[model samples]
Target: MTGRGADQRTPALLLAAVLLVGVNLRGAIAAVSPVLPEVRADLGLSPSSVSLVTTLPVLCFAAAAPAAAWFGRRVGARPGISWALLLLAVATVARVLGGPAVLLAGTVAIGLAMTVGNVLLPPVVKAGFGAAAGRVTGLYTAALAAGAALTAALTAPIAGLWGWRVGLAGWALLALAAAVLWRSAAGTADPTGPAPVTPAAAGRGPATGPSVWPHPVAWAVGLLLALQTMLYYAVTTWLPTLLVDRLEAGLPTGAAAASLFQLVGILGALLVPALIGRRRGQVGLGLVVGAGWVVLFAGLLAWPAGWGLWVTVGGLAQGAGVALSFTVIVLRAHDADAARRVSGMAQLVGYGIGATGPLLVGGLYGATGGWAVPLATLAGIGVLYAAVASVAGRPVTVGGPPSVRDGGSAPVGPAPAGGRPATPPGGR
Candidate 1:
C-alpha cells in the first residue's frame, strides 16, 4: 500500500534529519573554544566565567534530558525532534543577539534542544528499525560523530572570516533545514510519525512509569552513559583551551588540534563497533577502553611543555574510549525498545552526571590556578570506567520478544529477550 511505502521511507528521512541536527550540536560550543580569549576579552569574562559559558550547554544537556525523554514519549520522536530543531535554530540565532548574559541564556536553549535528540534517538531507531538495531545504532552514532567533527573543523574558520556571531548563526540554518526534513518525513501530527507502537505493558505508560527512573537496569546504563558523555564533553569544552594555554599551540592551531582530536574519534567511533560487535567480550572491551582513558588522562597530566604529540595521543585515546562507550550502549540493549530505555536512562543520568565533569573541572582549575587536579580527576574517572566496563562489557543480550530469551529479561535487561523496554536516560 501507499501508506506502507511511505512508512518505510520515514525512518530513513528521520535518520537524515538526525544526522543534520547532530552536525549542529557542537558548532556553538566547539566554535567558541579556539576563540575563548577573544570572546572573554570582548565580554569581560573571568576564566571561570568563560569556562561556565564554555561548559553551560553540556550542563543544560544533562539537566534537560529527562524532560526530553518524557516529552518524546508523550508527544513523539519526530514531532519532538522537529520542534527541538526549530527551537534550537531560533536559539542558535539568539546566541548572537546580545551580550554575554543573553548568549548564555540562549545556550540553555541549545543545550535543551540537543538533549531532546540525545534521548529520543535510540527509541526512534528501535521503533523504526526493530530487527537491525546494532547496525542502525552504529550508523546513527557514526553520523552523530561525523556531525561533531564537521562542526568542530569548520567553526573556527567560519568565525575567523566572519565574527563569532555569524559563525554561530550559520548553524541555525542547518537546524532549520533538519526541521524541514523531519517535518516532511514524520508528518505534522503524532510526532513519532507512523512508527509502530505496541500496547503499553501492564501498569506502564511509555512516557511516565516505573520504567522511567529508579530502576536497576536504568541505573547501570545511566552510569555508563554518564561516564562516556562526561569524558566527551570535557574534551570538547577544554581541549582547545588546553591546547592554547598548555600546548602553546595558539588559537588557530588549538582549533585545528581540537577538531583533529574529534576527527580521530570519528574513525574510532565507527570502527570500534564493527570490530567489537561480534565479540562476546563487551565487558572486556569496556575495561580496555577504561584503561585507555586512564592512559589518556595520565598523558594529559604528564604532558610536557610544548609536547603536542602527547596531547594528540591523549585525544585519540579519549576519542576511542568515547566511541567504545557509545557502542556498548547499543550492544547492551537487546531491542530498539530496550535500547530506547537504556539510552534514555544512560543519557538522563549519564549526561546529567557527566555535566559535573566540566563544572567540577572548571571549578577546580579556578581554585587551583592550574590543570593538574582536573587531569587527576579525569584519570580517577578512567579507573572507575575500567572497573565498570569490565562488568558491563561482557557479551550478553537482553530484552527481545518471547522467542529470543525464553520470555525473561536478558543480560542487560530484556530487549533481545522479553522486551523490558528501557528508556535512554539522556532523553533519547
Candidate 2:
C-alpha cells in the first residue's frame, strides 16, 4: 500500500480504539449510582454507607491519575490500559459477591483502574492525531458521555430484573471487549521512548523548574481544568440525588432527567470544541458559559422540579466549558509531550480538588437539612470559574518545543511509554 493509504488507515484504527475505551470509561461508575439503593439494601448498608459507596470511585479515580505516567512507563500505555480494564473486570465481578467491604473495595479498584484511561487518552490523541486533537477529543469525550448516559438509564431496570449483582457484573462485559480491542491495536506500535527516572528528591522538589511551573498561563490552564472538572463531576454524581431528595421528584423521573443532562452534555462536548479550536482567545466565550451555570444553579434552587429542562440547558453550558478547558491542554502546551505532562498535572490536581464537590454538596445538605447552602457553594464556584476563565481562555504556549515544558526536541523527563529512547519518532 502507498504511504498515504497507510496514514489514512492509522487514524481510523486509532479512533476505533478511542471509542471502545471511551465506552468503558464510565460504564462501571454510572452503573453503581443508579443501583445504589438496591445495593445498599442488599448489603444492609446504612444511609451513610450508601453515600460512601458513591464517593469512593471519584476519590480513587483522582488519586490514581498522578501515577498514570509511571504505570504507562512501566507497562506501556496500551498494555497498561488493557491491564486496567482487565482489573476492572475482576472488580466488577467482585462487587457482585454481596458483601459491603468487598463491594466498596471493588468499587475503589474499578475507579483506580479507570484513572489510567483518563490520563493517557489525551496524550494518545495528541501523539497520534496531533493536528486534529480538538476533533478527536470531541469524539472520544462524546463516547464517554454516551457510556455514562447508557448506564444511568439502564442500570436500575437491569438490576431490578436480574438483581443488582448481575447488573453490576454485566458492565464487565464491556470492559472485556475494550480490553480485547486495546490488545488488537498493540500490534501497530508507535515509537515511544523510555520512561523517565525521578529520584526521591525529584518527587519533593519543585513541581516544575522555576522557568516552567511559574508560568502564569500554565497556572491559568490548571485552574480552568480544575473548575470545569469540579462542576461536571459534581453534577453527574449528584444531580439525580438532588432531584429525588431535594426536589421530591420521583426516582424514575430524577434518573431520566439526569440522563438528559448527560445527553445534552454529549452534544455540547462534541460541538463546542470544534468552534473554539480555530480561535485564539476564548476567555469571553468561557464567561458566557460560566454565566449560564449561574443561571442553571440559581434556578435549580428556586424551582427544582419545574426546572429540569433549564438545568439540562445549564449542563450543556457546563459541558461546553469543560470541552474548552480540556482542549486547552493541547492548545496551550508546547507540543505533544508537554500536552501529556500538562494533561497529567491538570487532571491530577484538578480531579483531586474536583472530587470534593459532591462530598461538599452532600455534606452541606446533611448539615443544614436543605440544599440552600450547597447551592450557594456551587454558585460560588461558578463565580470563581468566570474569573479564571478569562485568563485561561487566552492562547499562550508554555514550555515550547525543545524546552523542557513543551516535550519538544529534547527529552522532557523520561522516555515515552514504549520503552525506547527519549526522542521523538525518528530523532536521535
Candidate 3:
C-alpha cells in the first residue's frame, strides 16, 4: 500500500482491534458474575469463597495495573494487548475443566489479562488516532460497556440452556476470535508506523524522577477518576435496592428503572463528551453534571415520583463522568507511553479507592437501617466530585504541566465524546 493509503486504512484497523479488545476485556469479568451463583452452587462454595471469587479480580486490577506499563513497555503496546487477549481466552476456556482450582486460577489470569488491556489500550488508541482521541475513547468505552451488558444480560440464559461452565467459558470464543483477527490485521505490528519506544528508553518517568506520582495534575486526574468511578459503582450496586426497598417499588419496577438508568447512561456518556471536543476547561460542565446528580438524588428522596426522569438524568451524568475520566487519561498525557503511565497510576489508585464504594454504601445502609443517610452521603460525594472536577478541568498535561498550578491560566477540561480535535496523526 502507498503511504497515504496505509495511513487512511490504519484507523479502521485500530478501531476494530480496540473494539474487540474492549469486548474481550469486560466479557471475562461480566460473564462470570451473572453465573456466579450457579458456579457457587455447583462447586459447593461457602459464602466467603463466593465473595473471594467476586473480589479477587477487582483487587487484581488494583495490584496488577502498574505492571501493565512495565509489560507493555517491554513488548510494545500492540503485542502486549494481543498476547493478553490470548491468555484471557485460554484462561477463560480452561474453566470448562470444572474445578475450584481451575476457576480461581482462571479468574486470576483473566484479571491480569484485563489489567494489561485496560492499561495499554488507551496508549494504542492515542498512537493510532492521535487527534481523534476523544472519538476513539468514547467508542472504546462504549464498547466496553456493551461487552459487559451483553454478557450480563445473556450469560444466565445461556447457562440455563447449556450449563454454568458453558456460560462462563462461552465468551472466550469471542476473545479467541478477537485475538486471531487482531493478529492477522496487525501482522507483526502495523507497517504504517514504527514500533513505539518503551517507557524506560523514552524517559517517560515524571520530571521529578523515580515516579510521576509527585505531579499534582497526575494526582488530580487520578483522584477525579477514582471518585467518579466510586460513585458509578456505588450507584450501580445500590440503585435497584434503593428503588425496591426504600421507595416500595415492585421488583419489576426496580429492575426496569435500573435498566433505564444503564441505557440512558450509556447514551448520555457517548453524547456528552462531544460537547467538550478540543477546547479545554470542563469546570462548568463538570459542575453542571455533578450537581445534576445531587438534584436527582434529592428529588428521589423527596417525592420518589417522576423517578424515570431523575434516573435518566442521573444515568446520563454517570456515563459522562466515566467516559470523561477515560478521556482525561488520554488528554492529560503528552504521548502514548506517557498515557499508559498516567493510566497506570490512575487505575491503580483509582480502582483501589473505587472498590470501597459498594462496601461503604452497604455498610452505611445496614448501620442506619435506612436509605436516607446513605443517599444523602452519596449526594455529598457528588458535590465533592464537582469541586475536584474544577481542578481537574484545568487544561494542563499531567506530568508536564505548564506549572504545578497553571499560573492563573484559564482553566480547561470539558470535551464531548464526539468529534476529536484535529491534531496531526503522528503527533504522538
10 residues in a row with least lDDT, candidate 1: 201-210
* Over 4 Å off, model 2: 1-9, 186-190, 200-213, 236-253, 302-306, 366-373, 401-428
User: What would the per-residue lDDT of candidate 2 be over residues 26-139, giving only the tens digit for each residue?
Assistant: 778877777877787778999888877777776765677668755654444555677788898898898778688888888888888887787667656666665566567767
Alpha carbon deviation, residue 116, candidate 1 (Å): 0.6
- List runs of model 3 lying over 4 Å from the truth: 1-9, 190-210, 400-428
Please give the lDDT score for candidate 3: 0.73
**What does the lDDT read for residue 130 in candidate 3?**
75
Residue-level lDDT tens digits of model 1 in 223-285 = 876787777677666767776667676778766766666776666566565756465456666
TM-score preference between candidates 1 and 3, better one: 3
Residues 58-80 of candidate 3: C-alpha lDDT, one tens digit per residue: 77877888787777766766778
Give candidates' CA RMSD values in order: 5.5, 6.0, 4.6
Q: How close is every model to the real structure, measured as TM-score?
A: 0.78, 0.83, 0.86
Best by TM-score: 3
Ranking by lDDT: 3, 2, 1
| lDDT (C-alpha) at residue 268 in model 3 | 62
What TM-score does model 2 achieve against the real structure?
Answer: 0.83
